[model samples]
Target: MSRVLKPNANNLETGTTTVGMVARDAVVLATDRRVTAGYYIAHRRGRKIWRIDDHVAATMSGGVADVQKILEALTLQAMDYKIRTGLPVPVKTLANYASVAMFSSRPYIFIAHMILGGVTEQEGPVLYTIDWYGSVTEERRFASTGSGSPTAFGVLEDGYRDGMSLEDAIKLGIRAVRAAMMHDPASGEGVDVITITPKEGFKEIDTSKYL
Candidate 1:
């Protein structure tokens, strides 16, 4: 568990805390809004989560520019696929695309860790964690990334339950991020949470009450 929690050199350099959870009928992606450079705080309102499709979203924890470029490419590809096939991209398919993009880059691979979460008529709710090495793991319950992930994972693993309600899941996500903030200097300045559901698609919730 200590080994899993240790941040790679890249994660330590980039600095962030992002977590994703699979709920009964929804997927929640939450992250702190702070961006850092060494011991310096770069941005207080940085965005780590993005909506890629109607029901798919991604959270990042690495080189901001590199992650943004990859996510932008993904958004374009998803949009193109929907235009041509009249169907949303499969959750796993999107995850693989990200993996391939990183792996294909070889020695100069993209420096990013990502959590992709979404919902669909075929797969219900789903989540995947993609590391800088292009490794993709389909998370059955929850996944956390970045410098503060160790603390976040502790809270997530202890509190998460199968088939939890969406509201309960969101609160848990917030709690995990908050817990990470307490211990991880890189993570703080409030949190942003977004939920993906088959019924409502991608929706950002006002997390002020929870924060």
Candidate 2:
């Protein structure tokens, strides 16, 4: 990571959702957008989730600027990794490498947390959250983080089901973020939702429908 993750810095607060589903042959991931700056709305269409490669996408919640930086850095590194290895790294492996890079660059900084989701060329689909210190681990169904994670998780627990459809995923994502917006001062108002279907690739959903 080129930039440091500073835990104490209070620049921006955010909420994000990263969902991973394993179908018969593909994977899907989705994320939400909502950022709060102090007592005001910062960005309504913050694209917290992104496609860094054809088969990989990520959702982030942390220092907005820092997370953006990490995304750029990761994109470059991912391209390099693909070029050098001629293979697609598993989502877990890529995320673990990112964690190591972040901590090694600045151990004192705790500025970013992220969920990476993708399907390996051989291992099916995967989802994992990388913490401020760069610890990465797998999540079975879905994962969320940031200021509104707790509230959002409440909705996730109630609605998530195995092998849920793309429609269900979107519904649950909106409901979770909507509920979070109600209580989490740092979340809500405007929403940016994105869904990635393995073969079709990433699509930034119409914000009007989600909000």
Candidate 3:
């Protein structure tokens, strides 16, 4: 991660952290948006976090190109599967499929960690972290992943609480990223924050509002 921070200005460097806070019957997904190029800041508003469908969203970190490809493939697959089956893919089923696809990629392995968040058809909101090998597991109230994750997780552990409101959740997410930027060499200055709730699929919120 530190290596990415010290590269040449023309070389693209990126790092991210996804936080999922679970409440009684809902979940709030958030991420710190930071993408750099070597020592230079390239994009402050790069939305590394996104919704894959009406009820499923993900926040990803790692090799940018690999992550993008995996996301595109997964999106297409999900759409096709849904169209054919006439039902949204179950969260567990989608996670399992992603795991298989990512684990099988050869050339450049997808060194990415993504937080898959959404409300299940039968259950309430669910949150899980998926890794490069496609390993996925449920999280508690909150979880963070990526190069800056160690630091971000610290902040989250301190601020996270059950039944947190959307505004509070956003604040905690920003605070966690801010804390990470202070200590993580790979995580830079600018923070891009996004939110995904049951009503709203995915929405990028103003950093100033959270900061």
lDDT (CA) for every model shown? Answer: 0.87, 0.66, 0.68
Residues 145-205, model 3: lDDT tens digits: 7666788888888888777777787788778877877776657646766565556645667
RMSD values, in order shown: 3.7, 4.0, 4.6
Best by TM-score: 1
Where model 2 places Cα greater than 4 Å from the true spot, the runs are: 1-32, 85-87, 207-211
lDDT of 2 by residue, 63-118 (tens): 67767777787788778878999976566667877888778866365577887877
Candidate 2: which pairs clash? 5-109, 5-110, 5-111, 6-111
Candidate achieving the largest lDDT: 1
Q: Give per-residue lDDT, candidate 2, residue 47.
A: 64
Model 2, residue 82: what's the lDDT? 89
Residue-level lDDT tens digits of model 1 in 25-90: 999999999988667788899889989998899998887777887899889989988999999988
At residue 79, candidate 3 shows an lDDT of 92
TM-score versus the correct structure, for each prediction: 0.93, 0.81, 0.81
Count clashing residue pairs in model 3.
Answer: 0
